[model samples]
Target: MATPPSEYAMSRTPHFQELRMASGSDNLQGCFHLLFTQQYAEIDGLINVLCEKRDDLFKKIERMEKLVEEGEGLCAFHDSGNVGLEFMKETLKTDKKVLAALTGLLDMACEGRREKRRHVSRFE
Candidate 1:
């Protein structure tokens, strides 16, 4: 049966020490120790890669949050600008109506003066 990882770790420590002390030879325990050491190195490398990827993901999330805030600010600015534009348009419409009324008043005054001139000339 395969040993559990925790038990294998415990068992491998003493064997690793023994393998280090012994001369390089065809020893089964030494071979197993070397294999376990290689596997542990590979696992450590994978863990480092995973940590790097996690940090990159966090940075991307922060950037997205900042972008969202900027988008909201732009939307608010545009809404206020639209409201100001509408107010200006309404003011312009009122000003046009006032100008038209003033023009009509000036025309009536000139027409009344002409009628007075004609009546005065008829009397002379």
Candidate 2:
């Protein structure tokens, strides 16, 4: 029944979408229903989109770093000349592996939630 994203009235940001069903049922007069939903598959799509963006940015950064290193000639061998280069490369590698593993995890979790919600007795 719950979770994720935004645009305009809700910008495209990562956030859990909480749907409070105030009157979907008449029997629950004084109680409110709480559910989580991702309006446009936002939660399911977040990781892919985010990873793609980060991968692109990292590529651009890698290109720039390459240029800087080439310009530095022998300085590229010095640790001080390329402070975070190795770290950024490692991050790029980790992101690729992590993204592959995480791609549909949110979707699976959300489906489980939907299954549980559907089984809940409507009268309780």
Candidate 3:
């Protein structure tokens, strides 16, 4: 019997934590702008990682579906597959929403850095 993926696989990855830490520090306006740029880069990396994970998740689901079909409508490993399938559905939805939020944050951060540059240029 093939074991399903652990929920930990869908957890906040290491890059995610690094981004949080990088974005939380206080510094000068110039330094903050640099950090924000770095944050955007990190966010892009995180998004790519998430996309890969989501692809893997979908493949896992497909395998599960095949197993169920092979069982001829009865999952011998468990009484029913509904619980696991529903959980995966919810996880996928949550993952997508998180990605959307991260994208929005990246956009906001980029705009903020641009505005800061504008302010500095105007003062010079």
Candidate that would win on TM-score = 1
lDDT winner, 1 or 2: 1
The local distance difference test score of each candidate is 0.53, 0.47, 0.55
Prediction 3 TM-score vs. true: 0.39
lDDT of 1: 0.53
lDDT value, candidate 2, whole model? 0.47
lDDT of 3: 0.55
lDDT of 3 by residue, 13-37 (tens): 5554344345553323433455556
Q: Ten consecutive residues with minimal summed lDDT in candidate 2?
A: 12-21
| Top-lDDT structure, candidate number | 3
Q: What is the Cα-based TM-score of model 2? A: 0.32
Query: Candidate 1 vs. truth: CA RMSD?
Result: 41.9
Clashing pairs in 3: none
Sort order, lDDT high to low: 3, 1, 2
Residue 54's lDDT in candidate 2: 56
Q: Write the per-residue lDDT of candidate 1 for residues 54-118, one digit (tens) a residue.
A: 45655655565555555555544785755655554565556555555555554554555455445
Please report the TM-score between candidate 1 and the true structure.
0.40
Q: What is the lDDT of residue 112 in candidate 2?
A: 59
Query: Model 2: per-residue lDDT, tens digit, 40-115?
Result: 2454465456557656756765675675556457556777655555555566567566655554564565675555
TM-score preference between candidates 1 and 3, better one: 1
Between which residue pairs do clashes occur in model 1?
Answer: none
